[model samples]
Target: MKKLMISVVAAALVLTMAGCGSKDSGGTKVKFATDAAYAPMEYMDKDKVAGFDIDFLAEVMKEAGLAYSVTNTGWDTMLTSVQQGKEYQAGISSVSITDERKQTYDYTAPYFESTNMILVKEGSPIKSALDLKDKKVAVQISTTADTLMTKIMGGDNKSLKRMDNNTLALMELESNGVDAVVADIAIIREYVKNNPNKKFVSIADAKNFESEYYGILLPKGSDLKAKLDPAIKKVIENGKYATVYKKWFGQEPDTKKLLDQK
Candidate 1:
């Protein structure tokens, strides 16, 4: 359900920001902005940006015959900068495609399937989305998880704590400040795998949490969409995508189903 987004109308951004892209033998590299906070998708590995989305983007750009670079500029900066289409040409922070966001930007064909999942301390009574109705919950602000939880908890419910990032949201749950944290499955699964001693459990409620797809965020009418789509289709079909998927997830991706999605 989420990893990226910030509610900003992103008017013309300042073009003064330094540290942009460099040229390559092919041409100037496509500049990408990402919030290096979403793991198994995109996150900081020390000083370097590393994860599934980063590795996947390498394949995508290779297929498209382009050079590219990604920067860890945080979610809000990434969203607004990419929206302006000045500082960065595209964004790939596990950003989910939704109707509300479609009004602001165009997106490449979906590359990943995801859904919100609940991360609760082991032995918690919560089992589904409905179970959190009266419970304290934390979610990253302005994400699909935030949007959906707002509806479930009622618009102004104080029980829903919206944090600046999922790392903070999960921390709140770990500290018992909240009963659960709602975030994308990739994030939840990665956290659980790395923190086995945390004694956390993940629950997938298929009824309340529906399928969502992640796409490369682009500014409206951007030319990259034309170049990226075919490359995405080719990589997904020709087995390149599955290799990247299995590298991060340790399992084969459902390319058949992924291709069938709009």
Candidate 2:
């Protein structure tokens, strides 16, 4: 009887440990968070979440043998949520990998790169960044461009207005509430594509605009990075990332060395 009881206890311990080591029932499911409203990156399509980053993630996840789901959170919320180890395991929004972000969270190899650009209504007086001095400029709050604008305008540009999202900022530009908007070049592309009536153009030959590289944001110390980096390198080397780029952005990756330089 004593021997039988000890055997039962050992079996129970083994079973408990096995359960602890098992993956979530979602079956390799990874929680991917993005700003969902950023179309051509991640957004709602016919009640289904789909976009460039979503499609790219689907392919990458398959290549990595992982299953995943996406959550459409606000941009700033997505970043902070992942850092706090909330529901999401990774962030796939077109998030630029920067030294500042690195101080908070780890990032995967860049999947997309772009320069900062200005979007203004056709025939607008704001021909370049310099032309906008003392003029009202709009940007998404807490974005790289927001900080850059602050620096460009010389100390505090109290006239600068902040919006919660890109769409709103762009809308303000349309209504003449702001002189122009500073946004990612890729984002500007999609916006222009959808809003043909707007006849938009980039500020020609603008300096002080920073090029940025988008990366998959992962929680610091997460094992997911180990699986992600090599797989990303695979896509880059096998010409897969470029192929995906043409499908969504209507252009190929610019091999020119961009940002990430000192």
Give one clash count per candidate, in the order shown: 0, 0
Predictions in order: lDDT? 0.85, 0.69
RMSD of each: 3.6, 12.7
Once fitted onto the true fold, the runs of candidate 2 whose alpha carbons sit more than 4 angstroms away are: 1-26, 204-206, 255-262
lDDT of 2: 0.69
Model 2, residue 235: C-alpha shift (Å): 1.4
- Among residues 3 or more apart in sequence or in different chains, the pairs in candidate 2 whose N, CA or C atoms overlap within 3 Å are none
Query: Model 2, 216: alpha-carbon shift in Å?
Result: 0.5
What clash pairs does model 1 have? none
At residue 82, candidate 2 shows an lDDT of 78
The lDDT, on a scale of 0 to 1, for candidate 1 is 0.85
Q: Measured by TM-score, how close is model 1 to the native structure? A: 0.91
Tens-place lDDT per residue, model 1, 44-65, is: 7776788898888888787787
